[model samples]
Target: MLIGDVARRSGVSARMLRHYESLGLVRPTGRSEAGYREYSSEDIRRIFHIESLRSLGLSLREVGLALDDPGFTPSGLVDDLIRQTRERIAAETELLTRLRRIDAAEPAGWEDVLRTVALLQALGSESAGKRQRAALSSAEEGPVPVEALAEAALSETDPNVAGALRWALARSGDTGLPLLAEGLGSPVAEVRRRAVQSIAEIPGGAATALLRQALTNSDVVVRRSAALALGTRGVANAVPTLIDMIVEGANDVDAADALSALASDPASTDQIATGLVGRLARGDVEASARRRLTQALADIPGTTTSRALADLSNDDDRAVALTATYLLTLRGAQ
Candidate 1:
């Protein structure tokens, strides 16, 4: 076949075929009567092979080595190609994410686009200070997508930066609650903790509802954070977890305070007192935990708490008796 005919049939251009010949990749097996470059069937096949390899991201030099070097094994080269392709894909994916976030901001002009880009880069910066500043400024400037802020809040490890991210997310209202809710289910314990903490900062019925759902989360940290936040929000469902916190000595003081806050509501007063009294009645209630439970009852104003404290005042444990007596004195004074 003539060079033109070979080019037409193989889909390799004439210029490319000549270039391959110059590189000694392929050559015509024989000359035609007109002295035009002629290619045998074998030469045309080699041109097709080179194009096939190039499609796999092989450079011309690598393609030549692959075609000509008998000692070359494809395993290492193929692995390298796989790694390169993965890296390219990862870079493209990150770029796509950035573009999506920027578009979500709905930038009004070139200046807005540039500011959003800068804010995003700063949020991902290695310096905690830069991330903190970015988070603080996010609420003041053109809106950063709530998803971006929520993602940052979940992944942030630095306390200051995490606080700033949470504040920014809170200011965004419950827009990020769904994302944060998903974070509560993350396999990473720290991520689950952060997710609950961030959700606690967001104020609304949606956020409160999410915290209520998190009350049953398997992660202890998530449950505790949710309980504390719910307590402040005047949700009575946090009573059991708060009582458990007191027994376990995990933020027991805060849990007691939450119980007290709940007790302020006349409807919840007896429920809170009953939960505390029930823990006190348990055979497994340790002396210190029993006293803590007694102290927790001091602020609860009801006959149930009064009877429990009165019983505690006569207990054999000196610490429990004295603490209950002191509380009774205060109650009498009130």
Candidate 2:
């Protein structure tokens, strides 16, 4: 068949057929008297094979080697491709596992995920070439197996084990919610606190409800966790709850953190400042609590919080006065 006939049959153009010939990818069996190249059945087969391999992402050079080597085994190439694909899947599985673990009520099993990441890093260090590194990087960026890790975490009763899982899940964000929710009801206050803290990192409507429930929990630690969770979520919906805690709850780091969360937003600052001032006026909260709330309010900029801080700056409590002074300095109101 002529070059045009070969091109038509192979779906390649006549010009490409000549170029393939020049690259020794295909050769004509003979030439017509008119000087046109004539392809044989064998040349046509090679062209088809080249096209198939190219479609599979093989380069021309690799395709040429495969075609030239009579002993070339497609099975070997297929196995390598499968192995690479599996590695990519495994990497993705590992990432998702970490995410699920973070959201799990029980802790996630992050040892395997960490190990896999370490292995990838090591492979990168020992990579034979840039291509291997690129492949490894691509695999690393794939989805993780968070569900599996969450399941593994649920099987363990150890706090350390659970903490590790929580750490891994926290890195991935809200995927660990279901599992974390389970921990919220744990018998142990510490476990509940950890779970609440993990959920707080992931602010959502669902998480907000969970934290709200925790605020009314029997354990102070649990309640504290709820407050901190609300703070981390930074949702204005938590403002009323946090204010209530500040007015009625004992002076503690968690309460301080909750106040900070409330005042973190410019919009919430006024309400929080007003609440703090009210608490001070009523003498319902301790002097220490008042100081913490004053500082938290001062952390917020603008006129409302600033005026609130100025009132507290002359309070009988030295700490409250100092904190208010510090806030005034921060706001350039000194």
Candidate 3:
């Protein structure tokens, strides 16, 4: 076949076919009557091969090596190609995400678009301080999409940056709650904790509801953060987790404070007191845990807590007896 016919038939442009020949990738096996380049069946086949390899993100050099070098092994090259393809896809996906967030911001003009883009770039900056500043400034300029803020809040490791991101998300509104809630289900324990903590900062019935739901999360950290937030919100459902926190001595002081807040509700006072008493009766409750539980009851105003405190005041552990006695004295004075 003539070069023109091969170019037309194989869908390889004439210029590319010529470039392949210049690089010695595919040589014309013969010459036509007009002395033009002629492509034999094998030459045309080679052209098709080069085109096929290029489609997989192979450079022309790699394609040439893949086809001509009998000693070349495809396994290494193929693995490299796979890695390159994944990287390209990840870059494209990140760009798409940035575009979607920019669109969500609803920029009205070029200046708005530029500002939104600058804020997004800053949020993704390698420096935690820059990212934190971006988060703090996000609200002053205007709301970045809550989705962007939620994603940052969930993945951020720097305490200061994460706090700023959570604050920005809270101000952006509960629209980010659904996105943040999804993070609560993440397989990463740190991510789940951050998600629940961020949700806790968001004020609203929806955020409170999410925290109440998170009280039952399998991750202990998630459950504790949710319980603390709910306790402050006066949600009584977090009582069990709050009590567990006291027993475990993980932020037990904060846990005790949350229980006290929950106790302010007349209906939950007995339930909270009774729950505390149940743990105290357990043989498994260590002396330290027992003391923590006893100290937790000081803020409960109900008769159930009073009776439990009275029983604790007579306990064998000297520290427990003293702590309980002091609490009872304070209660009596109140």
Candidate 4:
């Protein structure tokens, strides 16, 4: 077969075949009577082989080494090719993500598109200041796409930057909740915590519902954050986790305050007080936890809290008894 037939049969362009010949990767065995290049079967096979190696992302020189070097080992070169291919794929994927995010922003013009792209690049910047600025400017830069904010929030290590991203997501309303909720399911504990924290800041019944659902998350941090947010929102469902926080001494002061806030509802006051008292009554309750629980009771009013406080006043632990006594005296004066 001549170059034309080879090009037709093997799909390697004639010009590329000549380039391959020029590179010494392939050569025809003989010339036609007209002095045109003619390829024998072996040369045709060699041409196919060159195409095969080229398909593996081999540079022309590497392909030459692969085909000509008697001592060349495939394992190392193949591994290198695999790594390069993976890198290329990752680059393409990142570019696709940027394009999709820009499309989602629905830029009004080229300037809007550029601003969104710049903000996205800044959001991923190594400088925490840039990341924070990008996050703060996202809303002003034409809705910088919630996915970008959620992704940054999930991975952000800088506290100030993370706060700005959370604030941006909150300003986005509930649009980012689904992504943040997905973040909650991430195996990374920090991501899950950030997810719940961001979700908690969003102002909507939807966020409140997600926080309530997150109360059962397997991650203790997620459960705690969700519980605290729900407590502030007056969701009675957080009562159990809030009470547990008080007992475990994990952010117990905030937990106690949340419980106190929930206690203002006449209907939930007794329920909240009872949950606190039950933890206090547990035989396994530690001295410190019992004291914290007793202190928490100071904010809950009504006969249930007053009675629990009276019972706790005589407890064996002197500190617990003192705290309960102090609370009861105040209760009586009211």
TM-score on alpha carbons, each prediction: 0.97, 0.46, 0.92, 0.95
Query: Highest TM-score: which candidate?
Result: 1
44-162, model 1: which lDDT tens digit per residue? 88998999999999999999999999999999999999999999999999999899888888889988899988989999999999999999999999867778899999999999999
Best of the candidates, lDDT = 1
For each candidate in turn, give its C-alpha RMSD to the true structure in angstroms. Answer: 1.3, 17.8, 2.1, 1.5
Instruction: List per-prediction Cα lDDT, in the order shown.
Output: 0.92, 0.66, 0.90, 0.89
Residues 21-86, candidate 4: write the lDDT tens digits. 999999988888899899999998887888788888899999999889999999999999999999
Alpha-carbon error at 215 in model 3, in Å? Answer: 1.9
Clashes of 4: 0
Per-residue lDDT, model 2, residue 211, is 83
Q: How would you order the candidates by lDDT, starting with the best?
A: 1, 3, 4, 2
Clashes of 3: 0
1-334 per-residue lDDT for model 2 (tens digits): 9988888888999988888888999899999999988988988988999999888767788789888889888887878777877898999987675555334323245664564454334333333343233223322443434443344344434455455545555555566678777877788766676677666656558778888888777777677667666776775555555665655544445555766766767777777666666766775677666665675564555677777777878888888888888878878844
Give the local distance difference test score of model 2: 0.66
Return whichever of 3 and 4 wins on lDDT.
3
